[model samples]
Target: MDPLLLLFSLSAATCAYLLWFYLLARNLTGPKVWPVFGSLPYLFLNRKRMHDWIASNLCSTGGAATYQTCTIALPFLARRQGFYTVTCHPKNIEHVLRTRFDNYPKGPTWQTAFHDLLGQGIFNSDGDTWLIQRKTAALEFTTRTLRQAMARWVNRTIRTRLWVILDKAARDHTPVDLQDLLLRLTFDNICGLTFGKDPETLSPEMPENPFAIAFDTATEATLQRLIYPGFLWRLKKVLMIGSEDRLKKSLQIVENYMNEAIDARKEKPSDDLLSRFLKKRDMDGNLFPISVLQRIALNFVLAGRDTSSVALSWFFWLVMNHARVEEKILRELKTVLTESRGGEPKRWMEEPLTFDEAEKLTYLKAALAETLRLYPSVPEDFKYVITDDVLPDGTFVPAGSTVTYSIYSVGRMKAIWGEDCMEFRPERWLTAGGDRFEPPKDGYKFVAFNAGPRTCLGKDLAYLQMKSVASAVLLRYRLSTVPGHRVEQKMSLTLFMKNGLRVYLHPRTLA
Candidate 1:
């Protein structure tokens, strides 16, 4: 056969196969699907703008769409794979996340992608392994002693460490990366909580913590595995080349820190997570090995370190941009302070407010919730279907397919949040004809902390951290993004600001 003739023949066959699928699955509507390759090429081409692209398509498709990616099915190197459905529909989200939660575990595919970093921790594990970790962590988190410890830790850190940094930045008029600062602060806080010792990532000189740096690199590399085809990354790993090699090196750095903490706990046990985990044993009277300990430590750092910091960064950005929101928060703070001090605003301004006082700043809490709605810490998540399941909207997802729920896309769905969904309106979270905060009737609709059995155990702790920090900051300062500094989102496992939030802090004026 002539080369041109063969090329033309293959093109014609691809078109024919696509038309055949078009005839068969007419209801299947999403990105442009091709023959054997499915939608891989399109996804590859638009990878840079993936989150935005997915959100736009979901909005247009009435909050649900499927993306299918299969190899061209070549005998030598390629094989058939991938049936992915992404939904922002509240009903579908409820069904997947809550009602039929048992049918969707993180599954083998997710574990494969995150295994290097998360291993068999609570975030990555399923069944009995997850249950044991969950129970152990839950016991620790819900204790009143832990609550008192956290309150003391957070408030003391804010007054002594975080405030001093921002105060210097405000006085010196130096541009600071607020996100970077928060990252360090949270890193220190969570490390203290996890190991009963601070790594001092928040030192005035801001020295780079090797474990923190390596953990970040490892997580970023882990996310790339989800983007590239599994086989290619695995091949690269086997060869000890490229991102996989970097990932391996980074994981070693992270594990060293974990092991050091474990050693510290043994020599001098304290009331921290590591100490508690050391005392725990599973069903067979088998304690979790050091590897399991490492996984749990990594999970705590990932959950506690990044998520709250990133969220606070975004919240500050939103509050700065919307003066009304900021003013409202200030008003709420003033009211709380006045009530607490019995009308001594001057003295209240001078003294650092306690967590109990911060708790009454309802408007500030609502604003934080709204910020999360716009920018969830974990913007998108996927679960592998253990069995064939029907979503509430009647989407038929076959067994072995991965159904993803986009917390980012779902937040922007007008059908779920109404016509003004795109607007940065914290008022949506407030009560009708009143300024009081009101939560959504359907809990699954707002999944910042997730829903059902796997709902984040760290929810209260996160709030304690956020409320304590946010209230303290709002009472003391006014922040604005530095002029001409670019604020963009980074492509990662978590929703981190790409360049970080550069800002100049100004002390608030009060009469």
Candidate 2:
């Protein structure tokens, strides 16, 4: 047999196989897929701007109503069996989140990835574990005492620490990292509300808090487990190297702080969430174990700290860009001040808004809502499919596949929010009279807090905290972004500003 003839035969067979694979993947609406490598190359290339990349792919297929769902096929990576069905379609999101709620839990991959950081906490657990915690938390959140406790923490932080720092910055004419400041402010606030202990990350010196640093390290390392292949992270864990190694040290610091706080709470219970959780019994009529309590405290911090701060950061940046919206918010604040405090701008600027006063900030609330629509803290969320299911848009997702609903993409969809969806118009959220705030009736359309049974229990609390901080800052100071400073999004579990919101503060004066 001639060697050239044999080589020609093999080459022909390879071409035939490649042609078949291309034909099969041609109809799929997602990033370009390659043989063997699948979409890995494309994903790696666009990793920095993943959310926008996904939105572009979905939009290119067709707008929301036509082709709102797309598939990403990965040949390796055992999680979700290497198949992901990403969708921003409201109907499909509703079906996955509400109608077939039981069919989708946080699932094993998510639980496993976050177990060291979150344990069997409500956010990480499924079934009975999550249900019991949710029921208990729901009850506690509804209590006026808890809300009052949160208010006290928030007001004290603003009046004592945040205002002083911002005032100093204004006086010195120095640019400050508002995002970093907000992160510290919220961290202190959340720690106080969660465990009755404040790390005081927002102090005058703006010193580093070991506990806060450890928690951030741990959270970031844990997220790496989700991004890298399951086996890769697991092997790193076994070897005690890389991000897994950092996770171990960070977890130790986090646990120590939590244990100390838990011991203190046990000795003398306070009005914080930790004290309330300590008083409650678990599934087996037992007090939650030390381990469980630690995770619960960490979970609340993880939820309360990042989301509110990130949302506030984006809100400030948006307001800084849109002066018309800022003027409207100021006018509304002035109206509220006039009605309640004899219209003294100077006196009002001296103090933070009380919880009751923050409630009167309806337009400001709408602006915050508008900000969240465009920049959700958690831009994308993935749910694992339990049984084989058919989505509302006639797409079939297998039992082991993962479905990621893009909250960021939803805000950009023309079909869902009309042609002006991309515009930063708070008026869309207001009533015709412009006096009252109103959100879309469809829960799925605005899922920054998510929808259905798994909706955020801290929804009202988040609003309260944001309103308090937002009103406090805006009333006292006018924020201007630093010239030539770029604002870019960080690709993470949360939507953080990559460069931080660098701004100079100008003290507002009565005209």
Q: Give the alpha-carbon lDDT of every model.
A: 0.82, 0.86
Model 1 lDDT tens row, 1-511: 9999999999998787666666534545667656556567877887766788778878777644433333332222222236677888878888888898889899887899999899998999988999998988988888987877777778777778788888998899998898998999898888888888788888678899899999899999888888766878889999989889999999989888888899989899998888899889976889879998889888988999999999999999888889988887787777777788867656765556676776676777788889899999998898988888788777778787778888998788888888888788887888986467798998878998998888898887787689778877877788888889888888888889999999988888754
TM-score of 1: 0.93
Give per-residue CA lDDT, model 2, range 1-511, as digits (tens): 6999999999997888677656646755567667655666777788889889878877775654323122233322322455677888889999989999999888887889999999999889988889889999999999999899889999999999998898899999999999999999999988999999989899889999889898888888887776655777999999999889999999999999999999999998888999989988877899899999999999999999999999999999999989999999999888888787876677777678888998988999999999999999999888889999888988777777678888999998888888998999999989999889899988799999989888999999999999999999888889999999999998777899999999999988754
- Which lDDT value does model 2 have at 269? 88
TM-scores of all candidate predictions against the true structure: 0.93, 0.94
Against the true structure, candidate 2 reaches a TM-score of 0.94
Clashes per candidate (backbone, < 3 Å): 0, 0
C-alpha RMSD of candidate 2: 2.8
Task: Enumerate residue pairs that collide in model 2.
Answer: none
224 in model 2: Cα distance from truth in Å?
Answer: 2.2
Error of 2 at 443 (Å): 1.4
